[model samples]
Target chain A: MPILQFVERDGILDLGWGHPRPGLLPVRQWQDATRAALDAYDWQALTYGHSAGPQPLVDWLAEHLGTVDALTASPGEFFVTAGASHALTLCATVLAAPGDVALVDVPTYHFALRILRDRGLRLVPVPRDDAGIDVEALGALVDRLRGDGQRIGLLYLVATFGNPTGLSVGEPRRTELVRFARAAGVTIVEDDTYRELGYEGAPPASLWSVDPGGPVVRAGSFSKTVAPGLRLGFVQAGPDVLDRLAGIGYVDSGGGLNHSVALAMATFARSGAYAEHVARVRAAYRSQRDALVDGLRAGVPGLDVPRPAGGWFLWLRLPEGMTAESLMVVAERNGVSFAGGAQFHTDPARGHDHIRLSFSLLSPAGLTDAADRLAAAIRSVAG
Target chain B: MPILQFVERDGILDLGWGHPRPGLLPVRQWQDATRAALDAYDWQALTYGHSAGPQPLVDWLAEHLGTVDALTASPGEFFVTAGASHALTLCATVLAAPGDVALVDVPTYHFALRILRDRGLRLVPVPRDDAGIDVEALGALVDRLRGDGQRIGLLYLVATFGNPTGLSVGEPRRTELVRFARAAGVTIVEDDTYRELGYEGAPPASLWSVDPGGPVVRAGSFSKTVAPGLRLGFVQAGPDVLDRLAGIGYVDSGGGLNHSVALAMATFARSGAYAEHVARVRAAYRSQRDALVDGLRAGVPGLDVPRPAGGWFLWLRLPEGMTAESLMVVAERNGVSFAGGAQFHTDPARGHDHIRLSFSLLSPAGLTDAADRLAAAIRSVAG
Candidate 1:
């Protein structure tokens, strides 16, 4: 067995990690995929691949995404990357120059904040509502930054089934933002990682698909839908944006990132296994979400829990004046851990009353137990 | 088959492409390695890994590199990467700032030049002789550059069985350069990609090993010794330098680059498959080198051909006044292709008379035929 990725304590449930439960991973399917890939291998499959990625994987992704988005996806619009994070790095380091302002959703993925900051890009928070990023506020913020002589390099959002909040932007709002971004010469980078995880009805039109060929560049991944270990993701953008990504120092040096895996994934994807897998995964996560919500409501009074239609997280608003920080101590004592909301915000004060729990890491019964433990922690902390 | 990485001509012997031939690529071994990795995997192996890499692979690499270099390689000194090129990109974009001057060997690997240049670093050519990079000249060059108010961010060298020239820096020179770089406060980024494919004997001591725990940062890869498609490699440096690499934006977001492949490679190395494979590869390459050298000597009169002790490529010089540009016209007609040396230089004029022919991509007999065609091309061009 490999070393554990995170620290674990006996008798404690980790609701903090926003990843799939061990049983959800297609270990057997992966072994089958590898054997198939090897059986159909060519020598060139093991050589330096096209800088855009292996064409077979790119074409496969294009077809799959096209069907999901309900549009004609062109192969030219794709560039395979190691994963969504690496694609963000391309945006942070390549599309945006250092010190440029990155307009981001208020309570974004905590790690994505680190990615932008580490690359020397300044993160300027844009407030969000139930429908997702407030377009008017984002426009004003962009204008304000630009007026202060700061160049707006990119506008990043987790548009559909977003992390930390589990929110999706409304359909009309998506179109408006794309139009505004293109007119303002601001590139919109959609972290479309959780788009396919919708347990309810279909997701809204993707920002990239809303216009098909605009500044709304996207980084999609098989991490949530398939598996993270593949380290395989792709960029959906116009030819100009992809050319710039491929022309970077490292991409040129290595013909393509993760060429062998790309070929292997292509085989897995082509065989209809990937689609079947994600369907089962979505159903499993939906039931887990329901169990957690039910337990939390019955056990913790006056707590506000916004049920997510899809994806992994449950963004909860604690009772009046109950900060995530204070509850974290009691939660740990009660043997449940969760990510505090303050770290997800650029200005910590904005998220002090929130806590984010993920249902993806446990079964329905396990999540219900975790919810009870967390509910007890909250009662103790709030009392 | 997937889309071809390079354009293939119907009748041409492609001596210009420098990579392992189909016969040498170890397809079956990779299949075994993947299967072994799957059998031994924990779910965490498919999760986001530790940013430095999976510790299992890190420890395995330390032991393997330690034995190869005859030094006690510490796990503290390693950070896993995609490959050497990706390693260079990390150095170019992360370690060094955009405007920093990069001092590189003249007639170095051509693509490496593109990697440096693409990342916005200015390349200052450092002259070389049969002994490798001229230390005295480099010292003077550094003084000249610093005097001109340029900050020297890096000095990159392929110190072992270097590309194009196929010549290693002499042992004493390696020590001197390491000492000089540390004293000068210049970080030496060693591209140690070709260190393992030595033919005649154990190659010279590595520069990183010459002065362990110094300012030297090395990027070693399985691309040359194993397969380019693995996209697995590691970085060796002091903690300070490693901390800097792991702290970068993309790395922080992704956990580690190519985590799954690293695990597979760990299994391959621990099984003694890697070392035994390299031994066989070295033997095969040694004979291929001999075949090309013998053919060129017999067919091309009055030409300068330096016999390489290890690695790929044979550096050839025209008798006089004939440019690599002139020879390319006739060589194409004779059904052979080579990389003109001019592209490998900061100043194209300096390498106009040199030509690089690779032996890694063909059989000994095929390489001999290619050399004969090249020789005829050279003779015809000169006349």
Candidate 2:
């Protein structure tokens, strides 16, 4: 379908949208932040701004990242984007040419794959295990592609709290991956959108933080932590990389992404409201994740569901002989819905027996009811 | 110079930023409108939205276009964009593949040309006259390109109150251009960014309005009329064209451009605040344009300064023996700045004796002073 059908149909418990639930959105906080921004900045808030974004926001973001991620970055190293998806699009344009090859995790964020492919970059799938992308396998694939006379442009990974899979690469593995990429002369684009949404404990050090000053471009978004409709995110890279990105005609011509909104977010960030909101949402999602995991385990026998420490999803391995597509049919019949894992895979056959359920978009009660419906559907499908 | 330097320096009168003057921006109105929107829509304003945009904003834009442009279009005919530049980028991607030919007006909006070229489209400059893009020249260029076994993918023009020229294509010419494009199997992308900012009377019928179902795609921006930082704009096209654009991975994956901002704009539009703001900005720019034209004519004898009835710029043909480059050096020495007309031209040599003066970013007194400085610079350069 040309348009992704994401409308919540009546009576269907949908777990497909990988976004925060409506109740978790910080509406009042944002309104106040915007008002404060407009009042303080006046028309400057509404003017066409620098392509890197407003200086205050850029400065604040740099410091904020240092405080939270233990990563020190110069102001020139940051560029605000419309969102992480937009950041990925910009990276695809600046980092690689149309015919270049990008190495991506097999069960990657589907839309990230779409964004890269749309830029005409060929994607080579690198298989992943529970520890995240298999670094040795990726290294071998890079060498193989090089042997075939192919130029490997970029290595894309959801290095922290990955989408759909919810696996984070360990710090040592991240270091190894970065070393391999630098050795192979491939740029690494770390999708860090979910890094700050840790439910149980802190996620591992980001690939960018682990190998600062290396060829790592990290993309982070406010969608998971703040609000998606704001369409605000940031890309952090070395000065050289950022300069190249800032030179893209889209940014150069338009003078930055989401300027007024970015200014409002800066106000929120400075006022300590953003952190508070993120904490509240993180707590809510943590409860939602617990409810979904506990309820699904109790309801469905022999279903291997992994508990994600951060991010939105819980990856469920279907019982042997029960395919995700078959379960989806029964789930839909029972008025429950989820993203079939096949959608996340470059090769659909590899993920047929898995499904990705999001705990971020439903209430705790709604999640429990969804689990019950899903269990009932599974029993019917097995029969 | 990969990043455009638009920073306003001390003690310099800059006419380089073709944006509304600070005092003219409707700060209070926007603050109120945003507050109202947040109160009314709450979390819906902050959630991930549809790829085409929020339905209310889309519907309002369709109706607004119908009322203002005398065009009839269904909601599906409009797609929200970050702004006109982003819209142009999206159109470049959807309408033509890389390495295809795009016939653009010679002195077109420079950023439009940049957007197309950045997408790897080969830009073929078609000469334009006072009336607008020279239809005969464009036709010949298309035919010549086709004769060379190349595809003429699209014809790009700033049909209404064109940037750097302020020439609107008459209705008859618009019809002719659309017919020619349709006959030649080439799409027409009319940048109507400044259409609504007409200072004298309403601008001519948009190319899309003139031929609603033809291969005409009209791009309009609230950036000029409302606020640039909102980053809101829309592309009006036949349902087929819009569907194709909406199907682009950029839109399908990101869910839409600037959703919360669009919703807030819709509220402002529905409340009639947007129209009032446009009228206010138009009046201010009109006076500024008039002051510039009068001041320059009186100061620099025999200079041909065309008074723009609408939009932001005044195109001036320098007196013989005075190149825009020489004038710019003298003007900069006198603490005044303006865009050398060559910057807008695909072939720089064609516009060396011309300069573009933007009255959009300065007060009447500031513009008058700038005109005096420019005239002094011209005289110095002539000597």
Report the first chain's TM-score for all candidates: 0.97, 0.96
- Summarize candidate 2's per-residue lDDT along B242-265 as a digit string, tens digits: 888777765676676788898888
Q: Is the docking of candidate 1 incorrect, acceptable, medium or high quality?
A: medium
lDDT of 2: 0.83
| Interface RMSD, one decimal, each candidate | 2.6, 3.7
lDDT per residue (tens digit) for residues B33-85 in model 1: 87888789856667777777877788888877876685868888888899988
TM-score of each: 0.96, 0.97
Q: DockQ of each candidate's interface versus the true one?
A: 0.55, 0.52
| Residue-wise C-alpha lDDT for candidate 1, range A166-245, written one tens digit per residue | 98888788888898888888998999999898978888778988777688889998888888877889888887888898
Off by over 4 Å in 2: A1-5, B1-5
> Which window of 10 residues has the lowest lDDT sum in candidate 2 chain A?
A1-10
lDDT (Cα, 0-100) at B2 in candidate 2: 16
